[model samples]
Target: MSNLKGLAHLRMSLDDIKSATNDFADNRILGRGGFGVVYAGQLPTTHRSACEPGTPVAVKRLNVNSHQGDKEFLKEILMLDSCKHKNLVYLIGFVSEDTERILVYKKEDNGSLDKHLGSTDLTWEQRLRICLGAARGLEYLHSSVGTEHRVLHCDLKSSNVLLDANFEAKISDFGLSKIGPKNMPHTFLATVPCGTLGYVDPEYAISGVLTKESDVYSFGVVLFEVLCGRLATVVKSKDEYEFLSRLVKKYYAEGKLDDIIFPGLVEQMKPGSRELFSNIAFRCLNQDRKLRPTMRTVVKELESALEHQLINLDDDEEIIGLSGSIGVYNGHELVTSLCFTTNKRKYGPFNPEADNRFSGSWDAGLFDGFYGRHGSYIDAVGCCLKAAARPKAQS
Candidate 1:
């Protein structure tokens, strides 16, 4: 508990937690998993240590009957406290009473990415943003943003990814995370490999050796799921399920890559960018763990594809290149999603969890803009603004 000293402000007494959750009422439950039940809680602003009244929170109470014990619960708290990133979920506080343990977090109004598989309207651009955000989060964990040591998310799966009030992705559930040697490039063996079935790296399964690459492997699977709108593992029949990766590889080898892409996404696909993404994903799926690119590499590759998207815009729309086409978006929509400007007009945090928030048609004008001639979005926007002001300068 000494490690928790710095985060004492986040500690909550059992009574306080109980009050916030209304005695753990069943209707307040948000979701349940093998380890616990997550309930939506409201922290009253009146309490000295509480968030504002009506501040939505997620309260995860350990299942008394479950095998997960106190150690795992505390591990998650410590891990969350140590990491901070826009793509990572924010922890609010925790409670530990006699024979009971609980953790708290800001309620990500949007649910997990896995829930949107059947969405008929999810766009490729939106999916790419979610995947890129998750990659950056994983990269932060592996590189230790400001520290010398690294952290292994041990569990990286679509289910562990929670969407914020906006559709921005946040990596969650660090109960199984492990810290690695400082500034080292070696694999650490785990007594048991930890992660979801389809997303687990094969090498970790065989050797019990865990490394940052294991997280990359899981992320690769997630990348495919985003592109395909299919679960990592799909039900083949009543009795069995198949790995989406295997099916995708089979189709890719046969040169029928279109067979694996999610329905609506095919029309949005650009040849060069699509191939680049597919190639990167394939590299990530390599059985030889050493063969997989680092998350940094993954980020750059994805960003490059996005940039290429800007370069390949429709002929008539060439002047206004998309910023995040791997370019940062030039329009208000992209600017809004990429920045801290929340939808103040909307009541409560925008809930994208129950429904796919990216489903609505993007404003054509919203995405219309010129980046001029720069490699990055910031530079392009600057260049275009200057061109627009050239006449004034002449006057």
Candidate 2:
């Protein structure tokens, strides 16, 4: 077994990694990028090195053109390695050789959100959940100044959101990500615009100035993608203003917002959904960053929307019992049937696996602000639980 070090304090021998990748065979390759290619490989676990357990991992091999980016890669790894949020991808280790740099990470099973959402395999509900999960991840990064490197996810889009077995979202690829202090305390200077074509912040695109607002704006484009089920950059027009945001805004202004929503959800969509969802989407898509709602707000609204979806609106006021099916948190974390959201203060974490087999670890309670609140929020959680209750339940 190779001697391993703490993340940031470690690097793997290139020969060992190369051997795992069979000297970099095409079949071993998992993905490619402007700066590198990721190969699927099995590396020696520091604890057990004999047979090479072949832990499923992605090995990011930096290309020759990334001479300067190599330094940036190291910096990115060191900075990101310390963050332990569930929403962010974890870096396993890395390898460096003469003009060669490779980063290793756990291989997410489902691949990019774009691969599933862009294809027909994903359902409308899944799309909504994944996007919501991703937004929270970004929100956490933006809100927690210490964890985030001041700047925002400069290149967020469907492609950058990787999904795991249960379809949870994990942000990946920090290549063009801007490093700044949070709350836009400083300006990020760049000579050229660096981001995916469809999701680039308009202001950043024209001025080469990076801000948290830039990331917010790009996230807006992603919101539109989630809603419209199409690429923002692909909205071609033979006339003036070929941008997807402009078109969406125009349609929204013309009261044709429904024309853009994904067809499958259109039929199942609930009342008052268009305005709320449209408003949320437009707020994210707002050209002026100041007008956009913070990621926390966006996440809450989406969660509320999902809650709205869980119960029967026609008879929602009455308390009801609940039952089984897949329940998701922020469209990413999937927990089994048992779930609860109470306004109970100081509620703690519940790990079902510790006792019962099903319902895994869940936060004791969410909605800290509404804790002990005597209103519809608490009532709703209770009422919904009653409506879907398994003849008995507790948080």
Candidate 3:
């Protein structure tokens, strides 16, 4: 690799990356970025001081068809080589060999947020935290740079967010990152259509205007997914109000915000928290880019919402008369669970250990919300062996 300018990529051979990835084996592949393939290859721990007893770094390879990835490789080495924002994917460096390129970051065991959200795996509360962390990462990127220079993650969604050992989110995929050009309008500009389908900004997707709002729009879709405990989008439109913007419009205009909320969440969640999410989701999907919340605002709102909804006051359960309920801890992820019965009526989880008091902590939503609403008067609030306390009825 020859250095053309004072600042150029200190290149490593792509053959090394290929060897780490086992010739791009399917299992080594972490995920598909917008245009490139992100591989979860590992390298020796060069930053030993920050490392634990033993840890290796992660590597991501660009796909051969990725025309745009070639440009992204240079930008990553030149721009993100030294910058260390916890939210942004850390770049240790890159490897380049003739036609192939590889970008490396710290390896994460939990993989992408996509694993948790897409599979029948993650609990609602876990998904909520994932959303908040991803939002904050984007928030930091948009503001961490100097005020004059702001970065926009052209593609923001669950898949691009990788989770480290402690489950903290780190945003990846710089191939679509669009930093505001100096001596140019930062407001909005026409560009080629980019980004994922469900998460894409409708206004931008239609007009080709890639603004900061486009990222916000994608975040809003992600927020909806977080609340619903599902992916934010689908290719074939599901319904008239399925588009996040329309849902927001209908909720504010018609005052039927509750209608769109995932019924499972509504039943388990506190009424106030439910309304708060609806309001924030409304703020994010503003049809006009000028009206949408910035990444900073979106992050704060989401983090605040997660705190509000997931907060556990064991005392509150007693007040609601749900001090004891029979439940499996983190029961929301169980797909084909059986309905436990009491008094000959099969409803909710059975309360065999009714004497035990429910300990409310971070992951109490399945008891409070999801599995809590199976029966008319049943609840999700419960200890591992006891029946959920029902203040009134769950339906």
User: What are the TM-scores, per candidate, against the unseen true structure?
Assistant: 0.79, 0.74, 0.67
Worst 10 residues of 2 by lDDT: 368-377
Error of 2 at 264 (Å): 1.6
Q: Which stretches of candidate 2 lie over 4 Å from their true place?
A: 1-9, 45-52, 145-151, 183-192, 235-242, 272-275, 313-395
How accurate locally is residue 148 in candidate 3, as Cα lDDT from 0 to 100? Answer: 66
Ranking of predictions according to TM-score: 1, 2, 3
Full-model lDDT, candidate 1 = 0.72
Cα lDDT tens digits, model 2, 106-197, are 77888877666455556655666677678778877777647445546677887888898878788877766666765354446664777877
Error of 2 at 388 (Å): 21
The 0-to-1 C-alpha lDDT of every candidate, in the order given, reads 0.72, 0.63, 0.61
Residue 224 of model 2 has an lDDT of 78
Off by over 4 Å in 1: 1-6, 49-51, 237-239, 318-395
